[model samples]
Target: AIAEAIFRHLAPRATPLAGRHALVTAGPTHEPIDPVRYLANRSSGRQGYEIAGALAALGARVTLVSGPVDLPAPPGVALRRVETASQMLAACRDALPADIAVCAAAVADWRVAQEATRKIKKAQGAPPPVLALVPNPDILAELSTPGPDRPALVVGFAAETDSVAQHAAAKRARKGCDWIVANDVRPETGIMGGMENEVILITADGAEQWPRMDKRAVATHLAGRIAAFFTAQRSIA
Candidate 1:
């Protein structure tokens, strides 16, 4: 009670998401190649984590399913930590019946077919061992698919190096998600791990291009848009 009161006193803004539930995925999943080796990306989880905070500020019960990232958990948000794509998918399933779902994690496309129980050592003169890869579970697609437990709003992210809008639009349709926040992460852009982002929010109606801004601002804007969506839905229903 004291904590809640303190939080409210700090910012007495209206919480449009009051009594709602939100689920978010963040960070980069680690696909183990060996006991000491793993495949991962440079996703800092900044945007997603900030999104979770934004949603919490709007009075939503936020559950953040995150991977390995060097950041503290957002206050007033429940954090579920996992290391693998499969674990991430399982965590999302366990936190179902959400009002909104954001699939923002940079999950690896594949993992080693077989995980070695012991550490792999380099042979003095022999060739390196071969590693077979298999596709990882598609968490976004699973939740976006039509189902009784599907969230009212499903959002995904696409970090592309080329044809950002085109690829993100195609991905939105392919993944069956309502919105896809697309951004370019080419080497020159410095957006993959940077604090600022220039994103295009692709939806069924059309693409809404957002100007370059801090990730926190983007999250707050997106959260406000989400609140408007729910408000509109309630009116329609």
Candidate 2:
């Protein structure tokens, strides 16, 4: 607690991201299986919310495209609420031309191919309904794709149950993202819907394991890193 306070006090008061924009996706997308039924993950969006707040504190104009969550909006941030993966993707595209992009939402991998207009009925001694699923649009991949309007920095999050580092490194390469923040989400870890987190930050340079701490602390650390990156880039230019 004291350390965090000190870090914030020592940080430069100048707005590092004054003219820059940051895009972030948070929470879990709910893929509709039926009119009243949906498939979703256990992501509480604490980490993503903290990260967005951290970025905003540094003077970044932040656009947070969030899925269904019960958290309040961060101060000085533009909140765009969404439900499914498709909506989230559209929201992100509309907020384009960002300087940094963070893919933190635990987007559902597949959604019902055909949604039922009404509630599915339960019959006696009848077979259950079959739901045909289809792959969702890969939002992170799209953001990382090299082209005009690509953010200067692209960061992704990988929640894994096993081999956290290995999977995240491969995901970073496969998704063409600049960095991947990997964390174990096994039930025992209590990170899925908990307040604290332990993560390994993977970059082209390598990976660094962070200690378990409050989500806000991690956000502060990441925000500091981002500020330093922009500062260095400006110096080089």
Candidate 3:
């Protein structure tokens, strides 16, 4: 680590992401069902946090809009903590116009239409109360929309239990994002909430399968690709 730091200090030009702004979303959004209850997922925020750190290492100014997670903020990155999916979307919007945006948060799709003010007491011979649900804002699609506010590159994540690549491809087209990183999160795979991951990166060209590795390694690889993308764009211009 000491040697790497000395090398970085000696060669400042190695930071390819200098002057770039990156916006990343992490963890699981908690949509309220009531004062003490909420809808959420199993995301631990490790992958997203690692990605933020990797980008920051490459010298990008990163803003991580995260949901409920116990992890500390990555060094050299600005952290924005939020709970509900609506708040996550608002935070992402506020952090634009970024050069790159990675939508890695596992936001809840539905939220209780109306949260109960107080907990109901259990009673015998009574039917259970039915809770109405409403769809949350589609953050990936919104950020991918073609506009001045849209980032140069938008990446979304798809966690699927089956047919991961196929679903992710469809999602990329539907969401209008530049890239989609798809992974199998079936309990058997142990990728979700686990230390490692194997992913399929879908882009305009095609899907590329990445070997199983630690989440931090995956983050470093993705950050390198992002830097290469900007470099290619600059060369073309």
Best by lDDT: 3
For model 2, the superposed segments whose C-alpha errors exceed 4 Å read: 1-13
Error of 3 at 12 (Å): 2.7
lDDT of each: 0.93, 0.92, 0.94
lDDT of candidate model 1 versus the reference:
0.93
Clashing pairs in 3: none
Better of 2 and 3 by lDDT: 3
lDDT of 3 by residue, 1-237 (tens): 687678778988788888899999999999877678887988999999999999999989999999999999998899999999999999998999999999999989889888778866668989987878999999999999999899999999999999999999999999999999999999999999999999999999999999999999999999999999998998999
lDDT of 2 by residue, 6-111 (tens): 6556774656876889999999999987789998977999899899999988879999999999998898789999999999999999999999999999999899
Candidate 1 TM-score versus the reference: 0.94
lDDT of 1 by residue, 1-237 (tens): 588767766765577788899999999999887788998877999999999999998989999999999888888899999999999999999999999999889989899999887889988999989888899999999999998999999999999999999999999999999999999999799888899988999999999999999999999999999999998988899
CA shift of 34, model 2, Å: 1.6
How displaced is residue 48 in candidate 2, in Å? Answer: 0.9
Summed over model 2, clashes come to 0
Model 1 worst lDDT run, 10 consecutive residues: 5-14
The alpha-carbon lDDT assigned to residue 5 of candidate 2 equals: 46
